[model samples]
Target chain A: MKVVVDGMGGDNAPYAIVEGAVQAQKEYGIEIVITGPEDLIQKELDKYDYDKSKISILHASEVIGTNEHPAMAIRRKKDSSINKALNLVKNGEADAIISAGSTGAFLTGATLIIGRIKGVLRPALAPIMPGKNGPFMLIDCGANVDCKPKNLEQFALMGKAYFETVMQVNNPSVGLINIGSEEEKGNELTKEAHKLLKEAPINFAGNVEPRDIPLGNVNVLVCDGFVGNTVLKTIEGVAGNIFSVLKEEIYSSFKTKIGGMLLKSVFSKFKKDYDYKEYGGAGFLGVKSICVKAHGSSDAKALKNAIRQAKVFYDNRVIETITEYIENSIADNDENIKAE
Target chain B: MKVVVDGMGGDNAPYAIVEGAVQAQKEYGIEIVITGPEDLIQKELDKYDYDKSKISILHASEVIGTNEHPAMAIRRKKDSSINKALNLVKNGEADAIISAGSTGAFLTGATLIIGRIKGVLRPALAPIMPGKNGPFMLIDCGANVDCKPKNLEQFALMGKAYFETVMQVNNPSVGLINIGSEEEKGNELTKEAHKLLKEAPINFAGNVEPRDIPLGNVNVLVCDGFVGNTVLKTIEGVAGNIFSVLKEEIYSSFKTKIGGMLLKSVFSKFKKDYDYKEYGGAGFLGVKSICVKAHGSSDAKALKNAIRQAKVFYDNRVIETITEYIENSIADNDENIKAE
Candidate 1:
């Protein structure tokens, strides 16, 4: 199986991305296809060599920057690295497409370019992270921020399938993230979504609070993009902001600095506890293949790990399982929609 | 000013709550009135006394537990400790009431017993938490889980008043906690609330995500109870769960166990953080008098800190300021509603 890597995607493009692809091919024995400017990709490829036959490059002239609008870029830059990489997956040239560049561009390009599953309402981005319980999937983390009740029900269906097939959790428990656990709580969208999810043909875990994320309360978590994004970003912001504060405190005085030295190893371990990059990377759930979205600041190690995760995702045939789940769920999903 | 303490409230009832009240009286030079079984309150009070004249015990027989239904208890136990304490505030026998019992019971009694201000749509519970910019208040944390656009607009007004009084900032920046920063990114309630707050007579900073909370992006955060509660609990859960996992890892092996011993002091500092009790309790906003809600598991220190916060609330005349703000906000709020 060949893995398509966006050579122009991410902050350290052409260098870290190229180096990461080479490391994965060498270590994991996977065929790699790198997409970007052919000349720049060659210069980076010259830095690494075990077998030139193990890796290939696809030429693309344009690169999407961080500030570029995702929809606009996808529309205008049809031959961009991200689009070229996705095209490889669409034509079955590659088993998956991975990118660390603009999330919007990847999401927009993946759906509008590569296409969505037949019964899928909207393709969601599901990323699993270390929750209070263990690893839990947060659906629509940033995709479709303003969701309708029907959209949330669809998110739950997609998330349940992904968790069960990819994560191998049987009858994966699906929870609607509400502000409170009570039935009458949440805004209009959530209030209606709660009723819809309960009636769907899935293991509904009822309502879950944001705090429950860390506790690993359920296998699949569903929410509108706005709330899900807030939860994911809050976890990141709280973890990052606190660590930064602690660093300032640890070096604020001479005695504390000395104390910080004696406690350096523990602090390093503490930093690892809250680091999302340490847990591989995020998955773009609704895509046909095993495409994953690595963090923009992903290093070589994280990228390699993400590549391995994508291989496992492909081997699991997650798309086939999701298709079956969707087919089985149509009657119930439609019933809930009509009922609500 | 006299502060009424519910002696039968909290986990370590009569002891911690009573002792905390006695300490407040002696240390802060405030008159204290303890409400509970006369005998138990007197017994706890007898443990310390710098001035009996400064402290008084009011008799009440009923008790409220953390698990009890708050509204039912408020209605059934009219002479309960919470109601009795609130009566003291209502009758001008005490300037404020402090209870660590059921939040529902306190809020119910505070609303029905002490009553709401004229034209105040809902009484929001504002909790001041540490943020990036400093301490910011999350209004209506759980007082009302479901809210309308008008309710949130009024919450913003009350939050601004709270900051001016207790937080003491000139026109504290108010932000709505939403999934995205865009006006149309939220569902019906949030979208309408955005329009209302933007036009309200206050300094509105627009929408803020959960990540912004840690960065201290906004001073007074207004959101319906569901979103606010989810954000509050998620932070609480993450803080507790992450620390515990790291602690377990440190003690999992013999070598790491020894490392844990040498790292005890540093770990203690780390532990000091994840401790939610350290951040003084949440305040009940929009009440006629200042009221602080401590965690159910609060010890003496937590209770003491909560009381200290109440002192600031009382001195600032937060309720009076809210009254003025709400009175001024009605016209703009109505116009916003009509425009929507």
Candidate 2:
């Protein structure tokens, strides 16, 4: 499968992205198409010894800044690396595309340029986060800020499909992130979404409180982008603060310092488990083509893992499965309406 | 100062609650009225040695369970310990009230029985959470589920008053909790609230992203109940999960076990810094009288701390400050409208 890489994306653009693409090609033996300034990409790729035929470059001069307005950037920067890369998938020239650039620009380009899948209300960014029991998917992490009850229903279906196919979890349970577990215990949006989710075809686990999220209570946790974003960021903030505080405490005393040294290996292992790099990228679900948005601060290792994730998404036919799921659900709704 | 304690409220009710009252009475030299079944409260009170005049018992025949509906329990359980304790404050027999009962019941009873401060739109639960820099108050943590822009504007005013008066942080900055920091960002409620906050009579800081909360970016963080509740619970979940996982890892090996034992003091200090017991309880702001909701799992130490907090709240005249703040803001709005 051919995977197109945005050569000018992310904070470590060209250097890290190019190296990661080369590494993925050498390791996975997949054909790679890098999009950016031909000379810059080639220079970065030349630093490593690899099969020349396995990797190719498509020249694109303009690069979208992370601070640029998302929709405006996508529309204005026609020859940007992300735009050019998304075009490859739109025209069926590549199986998938990976970008670590501006999340907004990438998600906007994937939706407007490549278009949404038929019957999909809106595309969602689903990221699998590490939990105590295992990893679970938080859909619409920041794709659609404001959503309707029906939109959440679609997110549940799409997230369930993606988790079941890409992650290979059977009959993955889906839950609506809410303040309380009771059916009548939420704001307007969740109270309505709760009813719709219960009727949807997925294995609907009742409302999942944010406190239970870390326990991996469900395989797929669905919520509007606003609440999902808050939950995701709060977890990051608390975890980072704790680790930093621990480090300071460990160095405050000689005894604790020696203890910290002895426990260094265990700490490193635990950090790796919670590291976002190991999870690769968040998939832009409900899009017509496979699109993965990697962390902006990703290094070569993170980029390589994201590329591997994109390849798996293509191989497992996640987009196709989501499409069928939405279409079938729509048909069932129509039949029920006719009977009524 | 006289404070009323719900002697049958928390998980360790009667025992922890009674002992804590005696401790508070002895340490602070404040009059305390314990509300619960006379025999049960008397039995627990007999275990503690204290000045007879400082501590007294108010016999109540009923108790409210944590699982019962908040409003329903407040209305039906007329003779409950929480109800009797609240009545003591309402009737001016006590200066404040402390309860470790169901949060909903306490909040509902405080708002309905004790009443709201004049011109106050809604009452909020403002909890002083420990952060990296220090402590910050998160207003409307789980009170009003859905709110308008005007309600958030009031929350900001009330939160600022509480922070400045009780916490003694001069002109504490107020920030609207949002998904993004930009003025144009966030959902309908936050966007409008941002505009109102700018015009409101307070030290209005711009929008605060959830990720910055743990760093104590602002002294007062305001949001609707749903989002605030989600953020609070997510922090708790993430912090608890990390510690649990670290413990499991520490015990998995002999070297780490020795390290854990040596570093136990440092770890315990860190835990104490983040512990809710040390912070006392969440103050129910915008109420006519002081009401502190202690943690449901509070032990004797936590209950004592909560009593101390209630006494401080009453001494500082927080309710009077918030009432004046709201009334003046309303008058200012009226004058502005008249000028327009």
Candidate 3:
């Protein structure tokens, strides 16, 4: 399989992107097409010794900034790295696209260029968050802020399909992220979504609370993007705050400093377990082609992990599976709505 | 001011509740009315040295369990401690009511008995969370699951009034908790609420992200209950998960164990700062009478803190202030809506 990588994306840009692509091509035996200014990408590539056969670069003049409006940038900058990389997948030159750039830009580009799967309302961002037992997929992390009940039902189907095919979680239990675990315990959107999910064809776990997320109670937790973004950001903020406070306390006294020194490795392990790099990137689901978004601050290892994840997505044909599942499921619902 | 305490409520019931009331009377010079089986409350109160003239008990025959449906329990269990305590406020016998019991039951009882402020659409659960600097109030934590934009605007006014009068923060700023810090960065409810908050007579601080919560960016953060509950739970879950993981790592080796002993006090201070006990309880704002919901697992210290919080609220006439503020602000909005 081949993956097109946005070489000018993320904080560590062309260096990390080029190095990650080289490492992925060498280890995973996947062909990679890196898009960026040719000179910058080539300069970084010279530091690594790898098979020249599997690696290639596609030069692009413009770069879509992290701060720009997504749809505007995608519409105006046709030759930008993100747009060009997405075009490679649209043209069947690559199996998937990976970018650690602006999430909005990437999603907009993917939807406009590659297009959405047949009958998909809105493409959702599904990021695999590390939990106690393992990892669970959180759909619509920041993709669609306002979602209808039908959208949430579709998200559950898409998330389940991706989890089953890519992560190999068999018949993954799908849970709606709600304020309470009881079926009748949420806002109107969730209340309606809950009923829809219960009747849908999937392993529908009842409403799951945000508190149960760290315990890994469900394989696929679904919610509208606003709630999902708050949950995701709160988790990130709390984890970061706790560690910073711990670091300050560890340096407070001589005894604590000694203890910190002794437990350095343990602390590192714990931090690594919570790091976004360990989980790679969030997948932009519902698009016709596969698109994965690495974190904006991703390093070489994170970029490599994202590439590996994209390969797994490509090899398992998860996008095709989701499109077929949603097409079938939504069609029945459409007919039911029509009959009523 | 006299505060009604549910003597038969919470996990450490009768003991923690009675003890906390006794402590509050002795320390804050506040009169307390303890409701339950009088003999059981007396037995617990005997363990502490407190002013007999300041503390009194009201006899009640039944108790509301944690697992019962809130509305049904309120209707059926009229002789319960929660019902009797709420009746004290209804009969003008106490200034405020505090319960370390089931939140749903407390809310149901308060709304059904004491009623809402005349112009207020719904009461909001506002908890003062301990942030990096001081404390910030998170409104609508779990009161009304579904809310209108007008309800949120009223919540912000209620929250602002309480923050200024009770918490004594000068010109406390109210911020709309959103996915982003931009004006147009939320769903329909928030987008409308933002405009309302901006126009209302309060210190509207614009939009705030969940990640900025720990840094104490705003005095009062307003949202519908679903989003508020998720943010609160995410904070609680992340804090608990981090500590549990740290505990496992701290005991992994002998050096770490020795280091843990040295850092024990430092860790305790950090934990204490983040503990729910320090923040006392969540106040049900927009109600005609003050109602505070202490955590279900509250101990003596937590219950005592809650009693102290109720005293602060009573002394400042926060409930009355909020009632007046919201009555004026929402009446204007209601007129505008009617005109349209």
Best prediction by TM-score: 2
DockQ comparison, 1 vs 3, better candidate? 3
Chain B alone, candidate 3, TM-score of: 0.95
TM-score per candidate for chain A alone: 0.93, 0.98, 0.97
What's the TM-score of each model vs. the native?
Answer: 0.86, 0.97, 0.94
lDDT for each residue of candidate 2 in A52-82, tens digit (9 for 90 to 100): 8889999999999988898999999999999
- Model 2 has a DockQ score of 0.81
Model 1, B105-179: lDDT tens digits are 898889888888888878888888877557788888888976888899888888888788777799889998886
Model 1 steric clash pairs: A131-A214, A132-A214, A132-A215, A133-A214, A133-A215, A133-A216, B132-B214, B132-B215, B132-B216, B133-B216
The local distance difference test score of model 2 is: 0.91
| Candidate 1 segments whose C-alpha is farther than 4 A from its true place | A50-54, A64-69, A131-133, A148-157, A170-207, A252-265, A332-340, B38-43, B46-54, B57-73, B148-153, B178-207, B249-274, B331-340
* Inter-residue clash pairs, candidate 3: none
Q: B257-315 in candidate 3: lDDT tens per residue?
A: 88778888877987987899888999998788878899988888889899888888888
- Candidate closer to the true structure by lDDT (higher is better), 2 or 3: 2
- Candidate 3 i-RMS (Å)? 1.1
Task: Give per-model CA RMSD.
Answer: 3.9, 1.6, 2.5
Candidate 1 lDDT, A151-186, residue by residue in tens: 788788778777776778888898889876776557
